[model samples]
Target: MEESDIVKDIEKKTRLTSLKKYMWGPNILNLTLIIMVSQQQFLGRLSLLSTVLLLISIALNGITLIFFSKEIRYEENQQGIHKPFNKLTIRLLIFIIIFFGAITIGYFIR
Candidate 1:
């Protein structure tokens, strides 16, 4: 590919990466916080419905993360450097596991 072609493609991939990071990082955190506070303050902790909602949100985010990582890895294959993406995937996997575990614990504990 020409240099300009590669530049545009790189821009596309970087934009995808930024969107994925925002959705999973701060967006999920903010959503969970909102759900938790709404349940606590509005519902008076009277139900597990909010935890269920949080679990659904996390599951959807995990699926999106997986797909985004796959797309990014495809974009990076031309450069033959996969270590950084692998580390990111691993970290995301860990985050997914922890969130699922914590939500499960919160559901049962409460």
Candidate 2:
């Protein structure tokens, strides 16, 4: 392969790695929020601070997903793959939306 092709390969790998790293934060936060919200009796209550954090987490996850999706599309186009709808993308979006909706309901009810 040409040097240019090698450099592009490295760039693509780096971009994918960075995308995964960007996802890690929100994924961990989502898991933590799920656990905390599930334990109502153990925790006994939710605070305003927690509610705010939940909202922030949702927004962060969404922003990261948007960026990741764009990068994926760009990379796929570069690779000559025309798939626009990835199952994993759809699944993650649905999961986050449901999680956000549930948290919003909890925030209001609490």
Maximum-TM-score candidate:
2
Q: Residue-wise lDDT of candidate 1 within 1-110, one digit each (tens)?
A: 55697787788778666755655674466456445633454545635676667666666766766666676566567545566437556858686667756665555555
**Overall local distance difference test of candidate 2:** 0.69
- All-Cα superposition RMSD per candidate: 4.6, 3.4
Model 2 stretches astray by more than 4 angstroms: 1-3, 104-109
Q: Model 2 over residues 15-109: C-alpha lDDT tens digits? A: 76677677677667766766566454466677778766766776677676677667766766676767666755785778677676667666655
Off by over 4 Å in 1: 1-46
Which lDDT value does model 1 have at 18? 73
Candidate 2: Cα lDDT at 68: 66
